[model samples]
Target chain A: MTYVKPLPELTHEDRPFWEAAREHRFILPRCRDCGHIWFPPYSSCQKCLSFDREWIEASGRGTVWGYTIMCQPYVPGYADEMPYNVVLVELEEGPLLYSNLVGVPDEEIRPDIPVEAFFDDVTDDFTLIRFRPRNRTGE
Target chain B: MSKAEFSGRTAIVGIATSDFKALYGTDPERTREDLATHAIRDALDDAGLKKEQVDGLITGGTVHYEPLAYRAGLTDVRFCVDYPSAGRMCPMALMHAAQAVENGLANYVVLFNSLCFRSNQVKFGMGGGWMGTGLLYDSVYGMASPGAQYSLAFTRYQHLYGGTEEQLGAIPVAFRKHAQLNPVAIMQNSMTIEDYLAARYIAQPLRLFDYCLVNDGAVAYVVTSAERARDLKQKPVMIGGTAGRANFREWYVDLDFWADACASMKRDLMDPLGVGTDDIDSVQVYDNFSVSVLWGLEGFGFAPKGQGLEWIQDGRIELGGELPINTSGGMLSEAYLQGWNQHAESVRQLRGQAGPRQIPDCQRILYWGLSALPSASLLYVD
Candidate 1:
């Protein structure tokens, strides 16, 4: 089997983010002073510059804010995944996160479509957070 | 700043360009060099000067090609600068060149860009490395191409302000119709709102027609003080004012609704240029993607956020509308030389020399660099 490399290694600034994502939790920095969630996991809030922070779990349920169809595969190994959808998903909690939209037809993807979290296990150490169309089944 | 104005200081002394539609057919082909040669010659000829007279040069590249000063043979020039904002870099460089002339640092500055990307380049993945980083973050997650990046902006714009796809398509359709009068445009493919809406989606919310073409061409300009421009060959196109603004990171910021750089440009560029939205007689807002045109209009205060689409469709942005934008068909119709050619066209419009596509008494114009990182300049025929 061809091995798929996980996403780029996390830097010191964003290590908390990747560590939380490994456990299927979407983590963001909650400023102790301003009570705002920071994106890409920052150490301090630009608003208050407060170093005191807390990690919060996101609802992982949000609307499709915007997206791109990669007609050209960005990664050489993922050529077979040509025309996959990359999207900016606005989590219900208030942060805009980037991920691939899966399990749906390309034409059906539109603005404000509700989505829920899905994970990809590329390797033993890596599990990526992607999203798919919200459950349509009544159950 | 007292609202920067280009009124009577620096002028376009020369302009040059090569015929745009060349293709890179093979592996050893050098399309960048081809575009640079065309633009450098046209700009020098327009100014009635030679390569040896150039004291400053600025260029941008794709795929890590040869730099402009070296390839265009502007060697030994005192001021050499390269702007790598891709298509946006062209106008940014011109703004710098104009500043150099106004400051007495350079007598004549040449600004140029050669834009060409072959289909095979994508097929073989030859020059795809330039976008690899974007792929890792933005692209990897779905902001795949320029269309996708702009789509994110458009969506956020609609979320906050309410812009529709049909309204969004109006910007390109207006320019495409305007382009019909020019012979230089590539995608002369007749476009109507129906045609645009019916077109395939390159990225969600951005159809194929809504995107600008990747054509093979080059554009260039020579800037010098107004006093010396009179002695040159062509009518001096005065540089009224110039502004350059860049966002922190397009992917990080919501371009549609939250355009801080664009807002800064309005205060810094328009105030100093001494022209309000109504003062502009004609314009050449970059159309790298149609949404960019909308963002530029809103950013420049020509229209409010999300209302740019309505302004475009209501016949206000057409050739005979309140404002005539992209008279040389802009990047949508004529050539997408990384918006370098937009500057040359501004000079042509100000000179009343844009044959066949000329706007009557077209003076007092505004030229936007690109949408993502807003940069702008105002020029006039004084």
Candidate 2:
């Protein structure tokens, strides 16, 4: 069986973030002036409100800040993936990113668990950034 | 000009709620406008004020004041305002209405909310309707519903605080105990910690029992000057002090910062009332999800930080406990009216009108509108 999930409606500000994920490298906007790093791809820095920003490649390492096992499919596309894990990762650089935690059982997932980013090319046009335990690699 | 002037200047003179359970799985015979009109009429009758006397209109959550005024036969409305996106600002609508009345913008104001989620088949957490830039990150990852959003926060809370599902189970159990006494509560069936633990998980860290009932209902309140309220039909529940604040912009990504956010509102609300946490006899914390109540308990100074689950385990939040919370069963057991039911329960408790579930000699009640981003608190005095 095939599944089609809801896709992100890309805007100019979001395009860079999604484009970066396609290459299997994690990146976020950083303020050149006030030295603040932020997520969700804002043109200006949230702290200093400065447009002097750059997209820096992140370390692809973060700790599990929090997570949940989606017991029910909120969207029809997730019907087969019942009880999947949705995790919030606090990137080493400072921003928290929302993604899924794979390669770990739901009960083993906990806050402060070390994880690394991995990419899933759901389609040719879109790629999703997911995470797994820092120990194991391969899908 | 200052908190001193705002305290006790405006009062809630009348309150009314539509039948909560009756609207479940029912057909859409009443539009949102009709429900709003019905609640307004009921509130007007409760206050013994005619429709012509209502000079101000304020509403939130999909209610337009213009059409509601026309449907309620309110023609002399002087000040009209509508907060269409009032998620956590639900209780602040009363504060805004009070400000209008105090500023002489209007003499009488009706603040109401009407939601028909069941009848309209509105699924709240499906994501996609109003996608702001900030929410795009989570929406794209299948994290659409509010349950999933809040689960992230609560999961982090439990991890940091070291809590068990059995400890969290106490919240629903206690609320259901209170709901059993509330004749109008939608889920009056007795719930125990065992039942809560056994409930199917909607989102891990949050089960079916943790979520609010999606039923159709409307709640309305009439606000007027305190002096004018003395001549009305019911004993007035005075607006003592109201305060609200939003966390720094990282609200969506950082869940731990909510403790400080809640603490900020707590100080802002209590300072104006010239009272401390000890002065509040009862509370009506927003319980859209059970975790919200936990945050409210800690943020509102009812319990020490990171000890809300322990506080509930000690039975301090139950009826006949130290602080009787959600005396009308709250959103968990009561109907979900976007925290409007909490406002009505606050008024009822302050007036000593909450029959069997009434906290003995309730004097001052605190209501917290705890939500994801923006949060508000109200101090009501009898």
Q: Who wins the lDDT comparison?
A: 2
DockQ of 2: 0.61
What overall lDDT goes with each candidate model?
0.69, 0.80
Q: Residues B1-382, candidate 2, lDDT per residue (tens digit)?
A: 7877788899999999987866666676767887888888899999999988989998875878877777667778889888865456666788898899899999899898998878898767775433364336675677756777778888888878877878888888888888888888899788878889889999888899999888888999999999999999999988876777665443443365367777787777777666778988888867777887787778777788988888888678888989888888888998888888888988888788889888888888887765555556564665
Task: Place model 1 in a CAPRI quality band.
Answer: acceptable
Predictions' DockQ, in order: 0.35, 0.61
Candidate 1 chain B: 10-residue stretch with minimal lDDT: B123-132
Stretches of model 2 off by over 4 angstroms after superposition: A1-3, A135-139, B128-135, B248-254
Tens-place lDDT digits, model 2, residues A74-125: 7658767887888889898998877899898988999898888889988887
TM-score of chain B of each: 0.87, 0.95
**Candidate 1 segments whose C-alpha is farther than 4 A from its true place:** A1-6, A9-16, A29-37, A41-64, A67-86, A92-94, A100-122, A131-139, B1-7, B22-30, B61-76, B119-135, B139-142, B159-163, B249-259, B370-372
TM-scores, all candidates, are 0.83, 0.95
User: Which candidate number has the best TM-score?
Assistant: 2
Best by DockQ: 2
RMSD of each: 4.3, 2.3
Lowest summed lDDT window (length 10), candidate 2 chain B: B248-257
Clashing pairs in 2: B125-B145
